[model samples]
Target: MMAMTFSPKFRRVSGAASGESTVRRMALVAGGAAILALGAVGGYRLVAQVEGDRGIAPLANSEDIQVNGIKVDVTAKTGAEARLEGWKLAQKEAWKKLGGPDMPVEAIDAMVSSVVIGQEQVGPRRYIATLGVIFNKARAGQYVGAGGATIRSAPMLVLPVLYSGGVQQVFEVRGPWQRAWAEFQASQSPIDYVRPVGAGGESLILTAGQASRRSRLWWRNVLNQFDAASVLIPYARLERQWPGGPIHGTFTARYGPDNTFLGTFEMDAGSEQELAGMLDKAVQRMDGLYRDALAAGELRPDPTLTTSGQVLDRAFAELRTKLMPKGGAPIEALPQEIVLPSSTPSPVSTAPAETVSVQFASPDAAAVDAALAAVRGVPGVRGAATMSLAVGGTSVMRVTVEGGSERLASALRGQGWKVTSGGGALRITR
Candidate 1:
């Protein structure tokens, strides 16, 4: 009985049959792995397609228009021919969509810059595609009757803030509103816009929150940095009916250091395919609103920036009293006497021969004039001119003084200017 007993390991069927079964099992495993790998790749592609747009860059003299869902059926020698014809048809449609419906074929050909394919399908004798067409700005503007309005506006900084799906963002992320502004043809618009391309730290500082800041000093500094006279906040709130459904966009035009509300408009798109065009139209309408405001003189630069000799005189008189010696005595009777040097005035020098550099915080033109008058009001200061004028920031002025930089510092200090001496310069700030 012991000899008849067999271990389970050795009680198998024929070896060839075992090998065939093992091979079949391996085949099944490989097939499943292949299917899973294919599925993973397809899923990744689908996700990428869903979030595909990295946003079209702003073209200097071009306008982009989308021609969606163009289908063509024709008997051709090859599928490639059919696709090419379909693209041509789509491009023609794009021209029509851009208000060039009555344009001549030759004119369309001259105006078209390039065509980009979005989605395409090819069959034996049929083709379907979504095409993006870029048109020349100069030509397109003429066709759309846009260049007629003369834009004489001062440069204005633009902060496009988007509120979408319970999130508020500016240039922190690439949003559809930001993209629309980027792609907008500002040159054709009646509003002179100073649009930042959302680069580096500058964009983070200039945001939606900054728009609400009522501090004129802060706004002046920001405007000076960008060389803009004022700021524009174009806000957009998007509400979607459902995923991939109609989008309702509410756009509001706001401006100035005090975020004044200019106007608002409501727009909608049937689907995502039409969203970009809807946004483009919205931007144009916003520009038109700004144009109206500008015509009404509501978009003028800050009046506080005005400078005059009277302002300078008033500032100097105030500073003169502050810097004057106690008991109406001369500067020589002061605790620190600013003695004039004996150097003869050079022929090339218009006023005092010696020049002392004075740096001060000039938050506005008034501050600049005040600083200049304060320097010129000094006993031995013959003349003062701004060497570097950075309104809303630190400015440097070269003063033709009869004495040295130390005396200039003392004079500023006497006038209640917090003077810091560094690098042979007198730095003063209120």
Candidate 2:
């Protein structure tokens, strides 16, 4: 706003300032457009990389009890007749492997679910094949006796980690180790394996690096997604003599968020053609290691990963303390129905009331309600609420009672609940 004589030098300076300002604005606009274009390209590449053909869908019906390596060779008047005879022979042999008593081929056939042909050659009057027989657990359980009735381990998420070419991966790519685990039939095993198909976000989440993370919070979140109580890591490291020559594999069985090692073994394959079979055998051996660990009480779910009863106990204690009167005295249980004079204040009783955590098996919603109702029906139970609900597994509930946990356990026992008390919590069952 200066009113003065305009000099040429001053005018030229002013023109240069305006030009510089315009150039800066134009540069900013161009830079922003370039950034946007780069961002778009980056986003497209990310999407393509994640959703690309990098996943393998697991085979369906993995719960069936499978018996493999049953070889049959038979000759009949026709190939059809020979094939039928081979299937029947395979079933009979599979029954024997299952510890079943001697029975007619027709009886074994009744229990057979499906026949998987591994390799087959059918001629006009002959059939030779290596076969796998799948038996329906429900139909075969009676004949198999206690093998089908054994206690199964808690749901353990299976992360098949492959270390090949100096790289570790789980669900990052479709590898032989993952395929072997996917093809494994788990119904006959006592380990409840929860195998995730390496698709979508699963590939991103269940990478090899995740196995090394010991953070309980992160593990809890991951396990919750699959409804698993713990994690099982089957580690495989492969070494090849040549591109198409003999290969050796080192397999280790690990469990829990801490990646505790259970057992390890090594296997060899004659060539790439035998790699799948080697992996399959390695998977079976790994499963046996896990089973042994389960028997030794080494495969239990990590307590920190599940709902912490101590947390609920502490929260209940805090609430109780806040509601207490000025004096540090135990709160009394009020009667279900009370009548008092309008002008009289309610009296405070000096009886002790403690919060008890109760854990029980909740196989379904009805079982949850039943357990709650049963616990609430107990004599000293002033209130009961579900702290954690894990249907088809153990669930936890918080019970505020007029007495301590032992008294609550005794009361529950008296009510026909099989009660086990420890660690300030009570486990009850029917």
TM-score of each: 0.51, 0.67
Q: What would the per-residue lDDT of candidate 1 be over residues 311-368, giving only the tens digit for each residue?
A: 3445655666666556876556555545433243322212334777888898899998
Candidate 2 lDDT over residue span 1-430, tens digit each: 2122433443343578876766666667777878898999899978875686666666764556789989899999999999999999999888998899998888889888899987899999999998999988788877784642587887789999999999998876778899999888776688988889888889889999998998877897788677678999999999999999999999999999999989999999999988988898898899899999988888898756654333344565666556555674333433424322224222322348788899999999888878876876665555566779899999998887766787778877888899987887889999
Q: In model 2, which runs have C-alpha deviations exceeding 4 angstroms?
A: 1-14, 57-64, 75-79, 123-126, 147-149, 309-430
Task: Report lDDT per candidate.
Answer: 0.72, 0.81
Candidate 1 lands at a TM-score of: 0.51
Superposition error at 417 for model 1 (Å): 23
Best by TM-score: 2
